[model samples]
Target: MAIIRPARPSDAEELSTVEHAAYANYVDHAGVRPEPMTEDFSPLIGDERVWVAEHEGAVMGLLVLTTRPDHLLLDSIAVSPDAQGMGIGRRLLEFVEEHARAHGLGEVRLYTDEAMTSNIDYYLRRGFVETRRAVDQGRRRVFFTKHLG
Candidate 1:
């Protein structure tokens, strides 16, 4: 069973480790570091924007969310490489939608590298629609949004 909870200060290091391991596969394809690979989780942890998916007390995945006045941003979601193919990513995304609904937000938004076609398809299949495309930090990004009624 996996438990999803708010990230604590002590989980910072482990979160970083998970992030790096999860994103390592994308670095080569992207030809640059993925934003999540370089994000510092310390401040995010303090802000309670980070959540971890733990299995038997071991962190297996994580989701970072930012709440705005009108919607929730799914800033990042990563499942440890060792834990991939086990539906952790899907669970984390579901959690994000639930969290957004609970907060009275009607939508969720996220962005991913344009090169990650698999990820784009994953989100599209889950009901997210591409909102636009733009370049950020020299990387082409595909933005997506899901409206919740």
Candidate 2:
């Protein structure tokens, strides 16, 4: 079972590990330098909006969402590589949707590198539509948004 709750400062190290492991393959596949994982969670750990997933007492996933006046930005979403295919990501996504609805946000937005086709497809499958694209740091990233009911 997995429980999603507010992140704690104690989760930083493990969260960093999970973040790097999850994105490393994308880095290799894209042949581009991947952004470093959360080097320090001090800035994020304190945010009430950040959440982490724990399964059997282990940190399996984490997501940070920033609420804006008009929208909610999905700042980060990472699941341990080993936990990737088991619905953890979907669970987190659902949680974010609930969060947005509760906060009266109209939409949720996120961006992923163009080379990460699988991620793009996953988001599409989950009801997000590609609304824009951009070249950031020399790499193309597609922005996706999902309207909250």
Best by lDDT: 1
TM-score of each: 0.97, 0.93
Q: Judged by TM-score, which candidate is best?
A: 1
Stretches of candidate 2 exceeding 4 Å from the true structure: 36-39
Clashing pairs in 1: none
State residue 20's C-alpha deviation in candidate 1, in Å: 0.4
Model 2 TM-score, 2 decimals: 0.93
State the local distance difference test value for candidate 1: 0.94
Cα deviation of 126 in candidate 1 (Å)? Answer: 1.0
Q: Relative to the true structure, how large is the alpha-carbon lDDT of every model?
A: 0.94, 0.86
Give lDDT for model 2: 0.86
lDDT of 1 by residue, 2-114 (tens): 78999999999999999999988888888888999998999999999999999889999999999999999999999998898888888998999999999999999999999
Error of 1 at 77 (Å): 0.4
lDDT of 2 by residue, 1-149 (tens): 68999988878888888888988888779997555453456687776756998898998998988899999999889899889788899999999998888899989999988888998999999999999899977879999999987
